[model samples]
Target: MTPTQIAALIVAGAFVLLVVLLAIPLVKLGRTLDEATVAIRKAHENTDPIFTGANSTLTHVNTQLERVDGITANAKTVSGNVSALSSLFTATLGGPLVKTAAFSYGVSKALRARRKRKEEPWGKHSRRKGGRK
Candidate 1:
């Protein structure tokens, strides 16, 4: 054969050998991918019940929170009502009671002063003239 033809034949043989070497690892990768897919499917199947239970639990928790929110709203309303009642009582009762107490104290003081004046033994001018003339 000529040198150019021999070189071409060698190149083709090398290309075929490279293809054969690469195919072995490609087949192995495909098989590993298949196994991983099956394992993922099995895991999903096994955990379905757990996912269902979690969903049910989340629903229950949401319901309880809604109930708590309703209770809190009621408590807020009650607190507001109590505050209004306290304000009303202070307005209607507290003002008059304080005025009555002040009046009673003033009357008592006046009576005490009157009694002291009556027990004195001199008139106002005599006392002012230092008990002489």
Candidate 2:
């Protein structure tokens, strides 16, 4: 062969070697991508049941929350009723009750003072000698 022909053949052979080396990594990369796709499919299948269970759990939680809301409404109504009853009692009887208590305390004080004067019997003077008793 001519030198030019031999040089051309050498170049072609080197190009083929380079293509072969690149093809090996490309094939391995394709296999890795296929494995990743399979793993993703499996994860998707596994997550379906988990998502279903979570949905059911959320539904139940919402139901419980609704019940709690009803209870809170009832409690609020009862609280309002109690507050109104308290206001009514205060409006009706609170002043009179305070006046009665104060009157009773005054009566008690007056009675105690009368009893102490009766026990003393000399108007602030003791019966003992030199006022030491």
Candidate 3:
């Protein structure tokens, strides 16, 4: 072959070798992209139900919390009512009961002192400021 023809053939052969080298990596890249797509699809399928279940669980928890709030409100109302009842009872009977107790105690003390004086006419006692000696 002529020298020019041989040089042309060598250049063509170099181009073919380069193309083959580049084609190998391109093919591997395509396979890697396909694997990544499959993995993403699998993850999407697995997480769909998980998200749905989480939404339902949150809804149920919210409903329970609402019930708890209602119970707390009822408890507060009952507590207020009991406090009002206690105040009413104290207002209606507290003063009279205290005064009656004080009166009874005074009467009993006077009777006991008179009896003691009769029994011990000459006994020494601590005299009050202006009472009979």
Candidate 4:
């Protein structure tokens, strides 16, 4: 063969070898990109339900909080009514109760004084069982 034709053949072979080497990496890169795209699609699909569930949970929590607010309001109203009822009871029965208590105390004091006078007369002293005068 002529030297020039041989050099051209060598250059063509080198180029073909280089193209084959580059194509191997390019094919692997294409496969990696396809896998990444599929993973992204799967992530998107999974996250949709998570977001939906979170939204529904928030809605339910808000509803429960509203019920709690209503319960608190009712409790306040009941407390006010109870306070009013207590005041009414006091207003209706307080004076009579005080008067009755005072009358019983006076009667008990008079009975205790009368018993003491009967036990100890003013002109006499009693002897004890174990004593000397």
TM-score of every model versus the real structure = 0.63, 0.88, 0.64, 0.57
Estimate the Cα RMSD of every predicted model relative to the unseen true structure. 5.4, 3.5, 4.9, 5.8
> Which candidate gets the maximum lDDT versus the true structure?
2
**Which one wins on TM-score?**
2
lDDT of each: 0.90, 0.93, 0.92, 0.90
Residue pairs clashing in model 1 are none
Candidate 4 lDDT tens digits, 1-133: 9999999999999999999999999999999999999999999999989999999999999999999999999999999999999898889988888899999999999998778766765523434544334
Give per-residue CA lDDT, model 3, range 1-133, as digits (tens). 9999999999999999999999999999999999999999999999989999999999999999999999999999999999999898889988888899999999999999988977766656535445555
Least well predicted 10-residue stretch by lDDT in candidate 2: 124-133
- Candidate 4 scores a C-alpha RMSD against the true structure in Å of 5.8
Steric clashes per prediction: 0, 0, 0, 0
Q: Supply the global lDDT for candidate 4.
A: 0.90
* TM-score of structure candidate 3: 0.64
Stretches of model 2 off by over 4 angstroms after superposition? 122-133
Regarding lDDT, does 1 or 3 come out ahead? 3
Pairs in steric clash, model 4: none
